[model samples]
Target: MTRDLLSPAHTGCLQDFSSRYTRTCRLDAEQVQSLLYVLGTTLKANLNRSAPPKTKYFSVKCTDNVQYIISPLPQASSYLSPVRLKDNSVLLITMKEASTQENDNKLSVWYYAANKKVLDKAILHLTAVDISLDVDADRDGFVEKNNPNKNAWKWGPRGHGAVVLVNCDSETLYRRKPDYKRERILKSSDVKDMSPMVLRTKGPPKLPEGYKLVLHISQSDGENIRVFITSGERYPLVLNSEVLSKEIPYLGTDEIMFYVEGVSFPDKDFDGLVHINLSLLEPIGEGIPETPIFTDTVVFRVAPWIMTPNTLEPVEVFVCSTKDNYKFLSSMQSLVDRCGYKLNICYEYMNRGDRWMQDELEFGYIDSPHHSFPVVLDSPRNGKLDDFPYDVLLGPDFGYVTRVPSRKDVSSLDSFGNLEVSPPVTVNGKHYPLGRIIIGVAFPTASKGRNMTKMVQNFLWAQTVQEPIALYSDWLEVGHVDEFMSFVPAKDRKGFRLLLASPDAGYKLFKNLQNDGHGDAMLFEEIPDQDSISVNEILDDKQLQAENNYVQSCIDWNRDVLKRELGLDDEDIIDLPILFKLLEYRGQYRAAAYYPDMVNLIVLGRNLGIPKPFGPQVNGVCALEQEMVSLMGNLGLTCTFIDDFASYHKLLGEVHCGSNVRRAPFDFKWWNIEM
Candidate 1:
């Protein structure tokens, strides 16, 4: 043995024993026996029989007349295959080299004092455990540093690193792995099968229409669970989990409570398909000690509040009442509240014979913008009152307003009378510039013992004009303004459009003529001649029974059929039938009205028949109940009957808001439809 084996400078690769080489390398059974025999003989001939030498052990054997020791030559396993091996040549040679005791360390060294033949046999048993030709430490450090994509030696229970040791393979090095993706989190969440995840004794009874689920996480304390939703967005939510958590702990408390809101999306993807997915983020188990696990997998979409054309806006609408018809007013108020908008209502005085009262009443009572609700309110200008009662007929005005005066009145002077007097206008107790006062008259109060049918005719007259303005004699006594009124411009009064019905055939006509192609005919009130018509005439025996059946069917659709099938409550299913019947009724009116005037409009406008300008309104109306059910089947939908413009706006707002999520003020555009 020599000191070279222990020298750090003479390093060689013997780290991994299994991967590089195995137990059997160079000799057969007979060859090994013969080599061992010859090497034993040589050791006896060279060294003293009684004296033994001290050196690093390689492989040694002593027999009857011979002593043998096998030494790894400097070449060792590094020797490349020679052109050929001579017979009994020393591939596994046994050699007896002298030993130096200066450095006897852990490194394996060769033994001296052995015959070549005997040493060869001992070396044959020295199987190549780990034989590498590197001969240097740095050359075989880590394989991971060179190849990133390859799997490194990992220490986990399921990987190869578990079975391998550090010294086994010197070339392999370990690296980090990626995070696991299992589930997702939603912005606007949906609990499709909520029963399993949370304690849903009744499963929240399916979310109602125009309502959405907003997530509110609470810590064990009364405070909300604060988290940064956006990396840089400044706005943070201050949720009161007390309302959402109820019996549960605060967000990230002992357990975080998730408050979910119901919502839906239409055409959310490039394929024009509607879909829902969860909102997700890599949650850090920082504040909470334990690993946070979602008890329920929610279906949520990002709901961004924005100020766009589609985004909701609040408006205060003024409505008048006569003869204690507060039902209409109350209904309208509820509608506005439900639609998620603000409404302002105020009653005013109208002529006994004037058609303004009823028109105002209907305007005040709009189920939806599609269905006319005439309401009158004083317009506000620059934080000041413009007039006491300037009529504003608003709804889904497809385009512009067209006003036509029907007749004249002797007592009329408001247009000039009100303007002539300089009244101090005060809004919030502040005086402002005075403008021309216009006397807005809502004719024919359904109350006040006036004919309801005649009231509708007045509204009809106002809607049927093509020009921006019109003047006419009160041949029908529709309004006294017809007499003195002239040069009144059309103001796009969609609010004034009312669904009128006569006692005789009004209901049938109104129901049938909903989306008729004839603008003029459609403009005619269902109860065109109220004096001669009766409710009995319109819904006579058989017709009344049919209406009853239709109503019953609608009720069933909402209660029995819809609720049971969709797993909705009674109230949620109730509104669908009412709207459906209303649709049926309106459809009939439209069909009946179209035949007479359809030809004329089709001939005149040529390409532009009875303009389908009512697309949004009509779409909104059609989407009323059934559309909601179809849209949000998993979440239930039902309607609350809207009575006036205020409620109608609210409903419209809620509907629009509930349909899709709006991003930031500038993030989204009409062209961009993200769910």
Candidate 2:
């Protein structure tokens, strides 16, 4: 719509009534610049008398749907009277309503000087067209027309904007590949995993000649997301179709749909909010390209992958069955069967004998109001079982995502065993509904120390919902966070305990045994295949004691960091009796667990799978196992010990390293969390 320029009160007409002119225009209901605006400016210029034009004024007369705007609005507020016009000013007009039929509305304007009044008169025959582009901007299943909040996103129940899911899941089990890896849709079922966007138009059942609609995304968005359109005939938007940005002709239909799929997850460089634009392009002719007359935009945010904490219910547990792990597998089977959760066993053929299940991948899920699915994060630490996550886990409703780094950048720190998530906690007033992520890295000053690659770290940090915190683990030979600490659910307080391995506790336990005439008692006494050492010999080794002291200092450093980051007090933590032995490597020494690392245990609701630390017998029972039971009993947890000594303990990994769990997603939707 154009503003009606009114002239100063005039006494007489300057031009003859014979100066009448008429024109026709096609006006878009949502156009930013109206057709009448051009008509008004051209009408004044053609008068051919600039000096006399300094005295021209104009007024408009039209129906309720037509509005004429005037600057320094006329005091009379009535178009019946002439309003003054300033030099170098423009005459503008606008259509307020979408006409039901062609030329169903009319508008008229008169130009006058003083009271010579009418200098020139123009009549416009108008055809109004309506264009509405939409998406599930409110996150509801159905698309609503041009929502006011579509252009932006907000929070809370009143917030709006569509939620997009990263199409990382593999729909085809036969030839496995992530659905988003392809530029075009491969299966109809894949469509269900993406968000829907639509373009709707109505007016005269056809658009004006040379006018068209176009859908486009920003260059940055092209790398993160893709949009697909569906056409009924001729050129059906199908396989190998391009979706970056293209002209979409008016098909004389009321609606056209486009599906938005996230091809990449959020990262440090991307905040996850993406915009898709629809424009109505008008042909300017003379071999020139069309210009957009009106643009409608909607925003979408890629849903972050959320990590489930141990506090959540477990649905399934995954572990590999190698020839040497029969006893470990038997113990795991008993524990899982008793807990009533499903257990998946990867046989030698699938695993190829590699059994570090937890190091190969981490389990998490991405969610939206429209859909949700579990996504396995594959690690860069490619082991013999590297194919397990993609081959067996990437099925319908299941997804697989990974980050690859140069092999030189990969180390033991790159393993998923270094990855863990804490239970929900409130630090100050902020709450982490899904808890925060925990990963191992080198101490800041260790120039040559091993650390998780930046690619994986950025991906984890980009998740946003579970902000990740790095803990120093390079002091340990394996460089995995799980080797020294883990979380277990509790019935009270913070709802979980931060179990840490403590060498101090280990020495205290050994001293008590030596004082009770158990100095002759030996460690690993039951295992005939291994050498045993008496408790007195361990107490007398000053070198071993010094090594443990150094290990304690390292564990202490991380304990303080976790306390401050997780908002924990001493009572929120549990110190387990565990020891470490130092190994020399290239003129430097690193600590490794001397016994099965008991802190590296799997939590399954009330039941726990702990490594059986085979310490010397105390009154016909393993004193180390009894100590664990006594400490865990106060929290009402049942500790079931699994013997992984010969199989995994000697290999420097523990039960948690050999097993993985897929827990149920939180009942609380992630969208509600404060970002």
Candidate 3:
């Protein structure tokens, strides 16, 4: 009866055989012999081998009284295929149903050699017992369960169950047959004992938000163990692992540690798990090694920060205007109207007698024409001028909301009112007040001996409070943080996201324009001042190349410092394509021409005000302005373009320097919160 059951039947496809053999079929001597002959012939044909088999073949009857036979088909079999273990050992794999006598109907994998002999077998331990393996059991064309759109199947252990091959000499088997290569499996005893353990460090059960959490791994017996960390939550947690080594000269042994830094969670009450995976690799031979994996998880809750940007409210905005800025102001008013007239706009007139106005100098340093004007926060209102407070002076330039004003107080003053100023401190060859942070540009003209003391003093005075200052490249004439980056409230009302000018995107657009033969024409048409000069004369190819390099380096440095200070990731950044022009400024040197100023935008609540693109029109619309508006719309922001090409861009200023925001006062007191 067994021989008759095991006899070869003409199945049209391999799927028929896989579906039919759900139960074990006991084989007789004649059936086993016939299977072995067929397997040897198939192996020889597939391997292109002409030599006769030298090894003996045999069958093994499992404890459940089910006889197992390994054989190869004339064609490639989807149900039965050869797989190489990690140790470079080849095994013929097949799925067999659990015995009727056993209560558990678990998956059982049988391993055999090409010579039709059973080497080893084991029952897989499955945590997810509900997994269905009826389809793609061989994993030839299996699509990932998580990703349905993917066409190619991911190659690995596909099912939910885990298998542990027992009583197999992986090294000797690979040595005998050098052609075989496959993924390796661990022993059943080792697999059962594998469980990752987390070592404790100095910290409470709940960690404060934006604080770093250092974790140490307990010493284990294995020499070649690799650990990996991953967060299962949406909160951004940075992970850094120390190099694992067995040689420590000081301790004379291996020491390993993993550092996990917790950032400000998007939500205040975030509690989640961090998973750690440990893999122990064992070398089988000169080929690949076998690994046994263990997983462990840690629970942590993040405490909210003292104060965040969420408490901010809308307030009055300030802009400087002169007789030359009427057109620009008109355009700005139009934009404000388009934004539903939500913003409270105020104007400060510039002093016409200021000597700096005659030449292209630092217009930012010019005082307001009105003596009693509230230019710097917390300044004296008596019209008699003294040195401005360091914090208040720094606050306006950097646009930092240092302190909130009281409703009763007529003048907007900070907490440190009428306090005597302290002397600046010099650290690492740079002069700065104690706990004061200020960002500035490093000009190439500043000498080591001279040290640009006045510029440094001005920067120190402008800082509203002690904060971590991030310095960016200042190769451009009007180089400022506002030129390249802007912080806007997130649409989710959680925090702020940085909007950056992407040089990579701009370069690609410019290259496309150059290829289309409009590069020279566009430059000449945009810069109408240089009517006699050709595009080649206006733009030096060498300088343009150097400017791009500097821009990229500056962007990289700013990104790194911002990530550290603001706890921001790449996903939190919004990049816009804004290119710069290398134009000859004065008769001696070349400077960056920042015309579009898309990133140098004004934020009025949820709406953003930007400068119109300063260039030729493409199909009745400015190309750069259209791109900027489209990008802003994609980010869920309402964009209004203000034409400032003649009044502001020509003077090497943009919407940011021309205007400032006096944001709404929040209830949070800076003095009450810990820095």
TM-scores of all candidate predictions against the true structure: 0.18, 0.89, 0.39
Tens digits of per-residue lDDT, candidate 2, 580-661, equal: 9999889778989998889999999999999998887878888889899999998999999999999999998999999999
lDDT of 1 by residue, 1-675 (tens): 431121122223222111211111223322331211111112112111211243111232332122122222333442321111212112121222211221111112123333312222222222101001110011121211212111122211222210100010001111211000101222211111010111111111221112222233323211212211211222122223343222221111011222221111111121111111111122234564322111221221212111111111224333334344355456545655554544454343432211122122211111110111112221111011222223223212110111223333211211211111011122233321211121223322323211213222333322211001111111111222211111111112210111111112223333343435221221212222422222233234465545445433322322342223223332222121111112133223101111111101110000111111111123234212232234223332223422222221112111111111111122212112211
So what's the TM-score on candidate 2? Answer: 0.89
Model 3 TM: 0.39
Residue 141 of model 1 has an lDDT of 19
Candidate 2 Cα errors over 4 Å, as ranges:
1-55, 77-79, 88-96, 155-158, 232-243, 251-253
- Which order, best to worst by lDDT? 2, 3, 1
Candidate 1: which stretches are off by over 4 Å? 1-528, 531-539, 547-551, 558-561, 565-675
Candidate 2 vs candidate 3: the lDDT winner is: 2
Candidates 2 and 3 compared by TM-score, better number: 2
For candidate 3, lDDT tens digit of each residue in 1-675? 111112122222233233211322122212121111110011111111211233222222223212222343222332243332222121122223322221222223444456656554434221110111111112222312212211122212342211111111122222221010112222222111111222322112221222222222323211112222322322121222234321111111122222222221112122111222232222334555432221112321111111112113434444445656777677666766665544333322323311111011111111111110112322222211211222222221221111222333312111111111111223344432222232334444534211112322333333222343534434445445556676666555224567777766666655555566645535325544644322333244666656766676667677776655554567777777665655555642324444556776777767777877654354555556677777667667677777777677776656755665444333322122232
Q: Order the numbered candidates by TM-score, best leading.
A: 2, 3, 1
TM-score winner among the candidates?
2
| Alpha-carbon shift of residue 115 in model 1 (angstroms) | 22
Model 1: how far residue 429 lies from native, Å: 54
